[model samples]
Target: MSLSSSVEFPARFSYACFRLTPHSVYAINATILPQKCRLSTILTAPSFDELFPDALVNPSRPSDLHSDPFWAPTLSVDLSDASGIWIHLGKAPAAQCDKLLINVYKEYSNDSSRVSFLETLEVKCPETAVKWENQRAGKYLLTAYVPIRGCKFLCDSADKHCRQCLRTHLSLEIRENRASFIWLALHTMKDHSYEIFIISAVLVGLIMLVMCMGMVYALWKQRRDAKRVQEIQLTMYVKAMLIYADDCVEHRNCMRMLVECLRHCATCEPVFDMEKLLQPDSVIPSRWLIDQIATLPKFIIVISECGSRILDTTESRTHHLVQARPFADLFGPAMEMIIRDATHNLIASKRKYCIVRLPYSPEVPANLAVLNFPVFNLPDQFGQLTAFLHDFENIDQLNISQPLSQSRMTSFREAVRLQMTFFEQNPDWLDTRWRPIDEPAIPQIREQRLPVEISTDEDRIAAAKLYGIDPPRADSEDEETGVGPSNERQFMLHPPANEPDSDTDDDDLSTSEDEIDDEDEEGGEMHTVVFRPDNLF
Candidate 1:
């Protein structure tokens, strides 16, 4: 029987068969073969030399039908030694192909050559069936078959062999497919990473926004609190100014009080709005002097002994006294009318111009004037002054009306009486008593002597040194000696004293005196007179 013959074997039976060649051996099991055997002698088995002309056959090999053949079959295949095969499926086939049944084998030459059944799979050429002719020595084999009606193939007793299994059998065939799946997984991871980054950025922005809002709120609250404090301070400042104005008006010395108020107002560093108290058209006028005086309801005038002398002086007796008339002229007429009219009006109407006689001096006006109207010793004047400053403190309360329960007038009278008795007993007090205002205006008489003309150079030098001037040296003395410079000569000028003796030459004085006599001399009285003790007593 030839190796290519078909053999049939009975079911479940075991058999053994043998064949022999010049340099080969083959063993067969009859029971394992097909039941019918077809022995077609039309083709003869080729000699090992005929099958492979280049092969070197061993001559000492056995030649027996039962003995091992020169060619052997290896049942196992080593994929590690096998060359890989590749297959391509274009797009998708229009129709499925017939079932591909293949018998695979692994062959190994004694020379360590590797051959695989998978290599004969026709991976490059599709739609073809694969078959094996015979077994060879040093060869491994496997069988692969595609089952009809299934999406997979069967191989090596495995029921399912899909494209994934094809890769295990032939790694080269599915290289691109494996790489495609790897790239897809990487793309998915990239997308997930980007999403995570965006979410993190949004979260950070939200946190920053919350922080900024908190800061803004804090600043706004701080500003609101500061504004509230400023408003309270301003209100307090206004109230303080009002109180100071009232206090200033209550004191009878309105001008001095006004000056104090102005000083206090200037001391306030951050100036407050005192426009209401100082406005030109307001109840309190703008001028510092006018405001204090006009705001006081009433005031008293105190005249001292010195004031009386200034009013009583005559130009004829003491020429120096003539200088005082200008001062008297400034205030005299106004004082007389105010005192006379206001006193008369008050006495006739029985109105409260409560006059308490205090010692008076001529220089000081005995009457107080407001808008050219007099207010003379009015008891209600004290009451009015107190009412003006009821809201203020630190004022001269003595000048204002005392409470009815406390008699300020009686106390004042008793104190005056005591002082008068003391002055009567001690005459020295009268000498030191308040002098007339004219005393201040008296021209101090300096002793006069005829000035010696400094015609000599020595006199000029001495005069220069005495007056803190550069001395005329001997060199310049010759140019100007008799006529000295006007400034230097001033040190030598002195008015003549008693050269025209007035007591000895009365006629000489009368002629000059009548021409220059003061206006008061016509009436034989001074318009403003200082009442001496003789006139008063």
Candidate 2:
């Protein structure tokens, strides 16, 4: 479409200009009024309010003189920090920051006064290029740091805040892309924002201080409670017992030996045979076990790798001489005791029962596998068993505990002799007689005297007395060769390692007690009793 205009009026001089671009011909009209309008109406000025009503978002801080109406808040800042304050300007279409300007006003009543010259404080805008990554992540613009260090000029010392603050106004400007002059923009302004920030900062500071005090008090209380609980746990009169599968021969033997260790070496007095605790009329073995468990404060349950199989054994213990109730019948009560104890903390606030895994049986039984008082892994946390028992007695007393005395050693030997007698009772248990593999029935190898043979009657009596067993009588085997059943433990001593095997056919090459004694005196090597298989029949 073409138009012949007879009137000579400059389109730029009239506010009501009528025109449209090539794309706008069908979609838009650049002008707002009809073409047949009068010159008065065409030349009339347009109200900035009518053009952009929402442009004055904040009336107190209007756009700067050269700023576009739409580009109202071109400057942004975080004035909360008093020490280091910075003023930022939005990037131009060309992304140029060379013509940037910043000013700090001391006391400007309203924001419209920055246009003219005023008393400006000395400020520095350090030009630094920001990396593209930081610009994107931080939503950064053309950054010109107006380093308002200290901000001393903005101080109102009356109400102390952020080392005393005074509100100051700042403005920023950049070279305009389309317009001939540079664009001026005021910083984003809000009244009492600093006041709110100061108030919030004070409140936060108080809250943090109170929280720190509360944490300190809580820690102190926890430590005090723990100390009190420990004191309650340790006492002078601590009666503890040892428990294990009665069907497990290894467990029974370990417990029998452990009783002596506890009596002499350990801090607490160990109770092994609970049969004495049974009532005269009580027939149920479970009841006796339950009663013992209920009355006892501390218990050491011996669990070996094969303990699970022991629990599963329907028959009585294989090699043990003494038998009362089936192990299966007795273990149920013990399991019940474990379950009841683990469900809740004790009055002292810690688990009392300990699962003892000796070196012989390192693995824990499946029934006692997942205990709150867990079976500590071997070589690592295994000492918790002894630690628990130690808790039963006075810690100071345990620290000053002395080794077993001579009399106590005699008692220990007595206990060990009882175990040895029990070991010898099971005839099938000990394979002392060795026969040739080929010859089913050959002449038996006569038992040789011990390396330190029973030589004198007094030595025999002393040895018997040392083991807490009765000495043999004068008419018995005690006088013949001073070798008898009373001092049988010494017979378990291993012969010399280099001594020939007695399977040969030579009687002159026999070893007598005198020769053995001479050989023992000659060689300084110790004659250890081989300690007899730990009472394990």
Candidate 3:
């Protein structure tokens, strides 16, 4: 008998990416524990080439049946995840021809693998299978199987890029019969290497992507936390602030409201003289204020049309406004302290002082405005002010009422209405008046001489001014138009009780008047001019 032996070998529990075996090895689940199977380490006797020789000699015919033999034509078949491949032996002859042969073998798709089929098995191909197995064959064993150690498998599939089993070829022959048949045959199961490579690349890319994202987030978080810690480390004390404002009714109200808000916020201590700001005629408590100015962290000057007016150095300290400003006394001391501390103190001058402009207020001091202090126009820059006052990283202590209560909101609305009304009334309330100035008095006196051509009093006075001589004192008894010194009566000097009252002013002149009657009438004219009681110079 021509030698033929059955051989069996064990398979690995599961295949990984290790692509191929001698026969079709398809696994549904690689991790599942395999059933107990008897194993053999022994390989096939000799090898595949020696057993299935190219030459066959027929004993009955006495002819050499060798060289290339005709193989039956086969239909295309694929065996992946093997349900087992069908070999359709189409239209067999009506008479029994000879012994039929079924064969299976495998080799690597690429030429790189010189190692042959590495394992084997002896189990015969099942003739029929359950419905799910989908076996399709009529009579002859329609499927071929082999122990992996033996050889042969095909290279062609529709997908050309896939690994092909080295153009595996199949052959069949019949003895003492005329053989005419068609059949189906399969090469090998697909190893899925190309698809697996792509999937693994995508999976690796996804894992790397996740790792990169996580690293980026970690770096960002670390930076943010470090910055916050540094800020906290450098934080200064919240400190204190002093408010300087005008005597305006609305301004005072707003200042008081701000004071209240600052009180609510634990951020900074507000140092303000409520008494001086509130009272109708309060003066500065200079003695007490000395103690207050000892520490100065922040100083807020509330600016408004009214505040600007009050803060004016020369204008606000005028006669009327000086009394009008309730904080007049306080302003002087406060300003003196600020200027003293601020002089050459850059922090005190620039940083410590802040100017805030409320709505509907425009007046600003020329000197103060020139200082270029940080100006916050509110309620817009209110948040900026809070940030400015805060020193701690997480401590947001300067919380002005954001969502105010209804009552407080109503009050704020009312204040807004008042401010709008004030806006409507322009600069009419500003006092533009200044103090009056005066110089010493001096009278313009005429010349002490007159012209002789003068007849009337006007002419005589004119002539007196021109000639630089005395004019007649005898003109009007009621008015003194004369230029000469006349003997007018002295209230201290009185005529003797015995003597008659006379027009002469001098007691000695009365005696001279009697002597004048004895002189010429021309002398009488000079005499008359000198003795008139109405004459005054």
Candidate 2 residue 311 Cα shift, in angstroms, is: 5.1
| Candidate 1: clashing residue pairs, number | 35
TM-score of 2: 0.30
Give the per-residue Cα lDDT of candidate 1 at 256: 36
| lDDT for predicted candidate 1 compared with the true structure | 0.33
Model 3 RMSD vs true structure: 23.3
Best of the two (1, 3) by lDDT: 3
How far residue 150's Cα lies from its native spot in candidate 1, in Å, is 99
Clashes of 2: 1
Please give the ranking of all candidate structures by lDDT, highest first, separated by commas: 3, 2, 1
Let me know the TM-score candidate 3 reaches against the reference structure.
0.32
For 163-189, candidate 3 gives per-residue lDDT tens digits of: 321122222111112212221222111
Report clashes for each candidate as comma-separated counts: 35, 1, 16
Q: Where is the poorest 10-residue window by lDDT in model 3?
A: 39-48
In order, candidate lDDTs are 0.33, 0.42, 0.44
> lDDT (0-100) at residue 524 of candidate 1?
49
lDDT of 1 by residue, 227-339 (tens): 55321121222111211111111121332332233233322111112434335554522343233333432323333332343233342133221321111221233234335
